[model samples]
Target chain A: MDKFSLFVPNFLPCREYFDPGNNNACPGCGLALGVRHVYKAADKAMEKALWENISDTKFFGIKTNPSLLKIKQKKNELIICLDNEAGGSLRDALKKQMPGMAVAEGFKYVATACPSYPFDLYDKVKKALDTEGKSYIHILCPCPEGWQFDPENSVKAGFSAVETLAFPLYEAVCGFYTLTVKTAKPKKLSDYITIQGRFSGVTDSEIAEAGAIVDKEYSKLLEKIQSSYSYTFETTGKVY
Target chain B: MEASSGFLKKMIKCSLIEEGTAKPYKSGAHRKSLPEWDRDRCIKCGVCYIYCPDAAVYRLDDGFFDVENQKCKGCGICHSECWFGVISMVEER
Candidate 1:
């Protein structure tokens, strides 16, 4: 009936599809919201494919950390690396271990940080999954309890993370980097860190240091995207 | 006529409550703010009712959308999802 209704068509009749009425999730739980967006997007994407063609296609769901050691390691057609900040480090480790997995093999590796940028993240993930080879999607879901913030501020924190460049929204398809939610003027790191109780004790110098890291990484992403011939051609259509 | 002291005592006694009987425990009490309906602004599209995580938003008998406060956790999903920007979260006094 409604546009939002289309996102959860099959699950709406159950009444507790996403929230599941009687759960113990605290009020303003951002993780719950993140999970809902991610799951709905993935499920809806899969459903569309199933509806179009039941035969000649198969979908398998695999839940694992980026650390290959945690699960029985095997090459998957699509590897969705859903993580918080801690999980991002693990993803980095996996990438370091297998440098050629994404670029040389042309595996779709999408690394994103927040659900507040849902459309960009979801659409990229779906596109990556649709491709032939292995794909990895990294999502950063902030925890209110663990991060020491009021549950209601979860969405705000998520938004702040992106705006402040603490979690730059981007996707790396076949080792090519592209910034998704490109803010015209990014906010300072303090704007993001001040909200979360976990960073309450962080000093001014520490914030600056973290800001430097974000800036460096962002510049590197820009350079990587700029140098790539495909990205250049895709954007300006005049390849060097 | 008031009840007798003996009957009052029996009524006060604690008993084993049924499992899962505490479903939908007055989440409205936890809300810091509640979504206020703007009838004039609302297009009666029912987007609020459909996207509400708690399913607290409902259509009234006259076909206007309203919130059942008892069920609303004030997640603000409706406020965010409303394309018309009709729903606004007002702080509870």
Candidate 2:
């Protein structure tokens, strides 16, 4: 079938696939935007692979959340893990559990957020999937309700999270780490927290403490990437 | 009794609803603000109609665009997408 024909079917209103108009997601939900970008990116990547005569592949989406622990049904529960809570990162946890799959950190650039960043990151993800068989993209999808922000400010809050260095933008492809979008000067953590209602009553000392944690984590990531370069090149047989 | 059971099974089979037929529950009650259109400045380009995710933007018979407040979730997508800047999201009283 023609590419357009395939694309048209996916766009058609279906309960299975993510439809634009009928989604139950809250207004300005970052997860909705993130999911949409992933689908669009995967579609383009699949089309490119088809044109190149590569092996046909299927896409499977899995949403991992620790909140599923409250559910009783097996079908309703997928993966139970604390993602961004209690000093635990989901990408690291997944890496430890499944040593074989490539874990990548997908992030949006403040300069080119939304449409541009998602598409760019998708291409990187598609490449990783083709080479490594499986890839996990840890996207930072902000919650307006939980974060206590107006729905209209979801995009702004998402951007702020990255700018504050609370969520660094990097990709870990086959154990190799690469910072996708580098910030010349990251914004203060307070700038991000003050806008959200959840952090409305937070004190300056608390903000400083959180900022310190982010800085420490970011430095650790940089050190890990630097130390892993030689090993990554040895194993992958290609310099990243 | 056997004939009644057979008829009940047939009715159950026929009662399955068609996919995509169920209308979404009204979401306008969730809106904190509503988009108001200024007809004097509207060029009727229909950009708002195309970009509305909730399908709240409707074109009147006279080529003027109107938002169905009952369906609008006050996402401000139409306000952002309007090229002529004729649409403004005003606080809903």
User: Considering every candidate listed, which one attains the maximal DockQ?
Assistant: 1
State the DockQ of every prediction. Answer: 0.14, 0.10
Docking class for candidate 2? incorrect
Candidate number achieving the greatest TM-score relative to the actual structure: 1
Global lDDT scores for all candidate models = 0.58, 0.53
Name the candidate that leads on lDDT.
1
Candidate 1 residue-wise lDDT at A134: 67
The regions of model 2 sitting more than 4 angstroms off are A1-17, A44-116, A229-239, B1-23, B26-72, B77-87, B90-93
The window of 10 residues in a row where model 1 chain A has the poorest summed lDDT is: A65-74
Q: Write the per-residue lDDT of candidate 2 for residues B1-93, one digit (tens) a residue.
A: 999999999998745366653246555656788888898988766656544544566668897778887777887756765667899999977
Residue runs of model 1 more than 4 Å from their true location after superposition: A1-19, A44-76, A86-106, A229-240, B1-34, B42-71, B76-93
Q: What is the C-alpha lDDT profile of model 1 across B1-93, one tens digit per residue?
A: 256876766666532245554345555566788888888877676656654544567677786788886777777767876778888999898
The ten-residue window of minimal lDDT in model 2 chain B covers B14-23
DockQ of 2: 0.10
lDDT of 1: 0.58
